[model samples]
Target: MNITVHRPGDLTSADRAAWTALQSKAHLNGSPDLANPFLSPEFALATGQWRRGVRIAVAYEGGEPAAFFPFQRSATGVGRAIGLGVSDCQGLVHGPGFAWDARQLLRACGLVVWEFDHLVGGQGPFETGASGSFPSPVMDIDQGYDAYLGHLRERSPKFTRTTLAKDRRLARDHGAVRYVHDERDPEVLAILMGWKSAQYRRTGRSDRFAHPWISQLVRRLFHTRSDSFAGILSVLYVADVPVAAHFGLRSERVLACWFPAYDPAFSRYSPGLVLHLRMAEA
Candidate 1:
């Protein structure tokens, strides 16, 4: 296999189309997680706008695209997934049955260590490099919202009751609640970032939004709209005031929840949970 590295923006229309096709095929026939918008070429393109080191390694066989690896690198030879901090899915999107040596790929990309947290399943090339593994929660909502809710209620009746009761009380006390699945307002997006930043500080976690690049990247991603990759900014409002909001990436098959936050003033109401439930129901 011949490997060629290029900036994400350098990809030609044909290259981008092939990458999307390969990802879609893999999502249908291999791991369902490949359907995540974070794994799409569009996402890499958007991230590349704000990130300097974003590159795509395309492996070719017989002068045709075989696989695509999108990542960002540091001057110290360290590599990470493109949009690492905010991206929920990681790893290369390849054609079916395609395989390559992980170390070979890393060397080809001039990286000594490639770090990834949410590596998708069915990756054999990188299995040996994995030091530990943990389950990433995924909700199977293929059965529609009501069916999934019933399944949840069956599994955790008390939890479901409490969550629903809180949602009802929230709505009652703060006027009727409204949920916008794909909110386009830029101000709401800013509000989400602010809330997320405040939540990070409150929990004593490193605030990702503190970085100007991350903030710029998210704002650019909000305007990215396509069939395969679109920014989904969902907001929950009470009495016409935004109480909770979530900014996530979505494809036709999967909604990969990314950043979520709520007003601390409504902590007792669990507005975050209500927002997520409404997102699922929508």
Candidate 2:
């Protein structure tokens, strides 16, 4: 096996295609989380453009690409998952039956330590490196939205009734309520960021958008659209006004729930929950 390192933004079109192919193939191995959009080359590239040190290590066997490791390197030879702290999914993406030593890959990339959080499944080699692990909540709607709602209603009938009643009240008080699953408006994204930032400050937590690169990266990603990866901005509107919004990334199989916020004036309507339910239904 041979390994080569390249800046995420510098990867050629061929490289991007191969990377996407490997991830898609990996999804076939019963690890659908491998299909998360955050693991896609486009995400790495968008993040690389706004932040320094983003790199992808491509490993080849028999002159064919086999695996991809995307990370951000520190000055002291430490590595972290690309778009760390924000990316909900992380880990190397590899084709079936491809194997390589983690240490060797690290050395090839000139890193002494490679750290990851929320690492997706199918990473047997890195399992020993983990000191702790936790379950990542994922909404499984493979059986269809109707089945999911049925299950939700069965499990949380009270919660479901409350949420539905609030949705009705929201519509009654503020005109018809509607949901947009894939909103393409850039202005809506800006509004979501502002709401998220305010929510952060209100909770005494530091705002993620306060960092210029994170903000720019998000703005740039909003424009990125592809078959395997896309920026999804879902909004809940009442009387043509957005009461809640969520910006997330989507791949073929997975919809990563990222930033979610709502207009505080509509808190009684539980707009955020309504937006999530509508997003899931869509």
Candidate 3:
């Protein structure tokens, strides 16, 4: 096996195609998380454009791309999953039968160790290194909204009904409700960043948006439109006023839920939940 490392910006067209194909093959092996846009080549390219340390490692067997591992390499020989903080799901993309040792891959890229917090399932190499694992909830809408609603109703009837009631109340009290699944307005995205920053500050947490790169990454991503990775800004407005928003990335199939915030004044109305439900419906 040959382990080749390329800065995401340096990847050629054929290299990108190989990387993308690996992502698809990995996703089809019975796991939905592998299909996430955050794991797509477009996302790596976008991130590499904004961040300098991003790299993609493609392992080849007999001159065919068999696996792809994306990470950020620090000068100190340490590496972390690409877009570690912002990427909701993270992992190596590989063919169904390909096998590569994580330590060997790290060495080829001149890294001592690689770390991950949100590593997706099917990552065999880092499983032993995982100190703890937690479930990240996903709302599967492929079967359609009504089917998802049925599952929710069966699992948690009260929460499902309450969320639905909030949606109804929001529409009744505030004029017509408008749900935009993909809002192209830059202004809307800016407002969402501001709201999320305020949320962080009010909660006595370090505001991630305070970092210029994080903010810029979000802005650029909002403008990115592609099949593998497109920024999805789901908005909920009542009476023509913005109440809640969630900015996430989506591939053809999965939505990698990301930064979600709502107007504090509308907290009682639970516009956040309302936005998500409407988003899922869309």
TM-score winner among the candidates?
A: 2
Candidate 1 structure quality by residue, lDDT tens digits, 144-241: 99999999999999988999999999988889888899999999999999999998999999999999988888888899887777889999999889
Work out candidate 1's RMSD over C-alphas. 1.4
**Model 3 off-target regions past 4 Å?**
none
Q: Pick the lDDT winner.
A: 2
Consecutive 10-residue window with the lowest summed lDDT within model 1: 23-32
Cα lDDT of candidate 1 equals 0.88
Q: What is the model-wide C-alpha lDDT for candidate 3?
A: 0.84
TM-score of 2: 0.97
Ranking by TM-score: 2, 3, 1
Per-residue lDDT tens digits of candidate 2, residues 1-282?
999999876688987898888767665776677788899998998999987788999998899888889999999999998998899889988877777788988999999998888888778888889888899877788999999989999999999999989999998888999899999999999999999999999999999999999899888888998888889999999988999999999887788899999999999989999899899889
Candidate 3, pairs of clashing residues: none
* lDDT values for all models: 0.88, 0.89, 0.84
Q: TM-scores of all models? A: 0.95, 0.97, 0.96
* lDDT score of residue 85 within candidate 1: 74
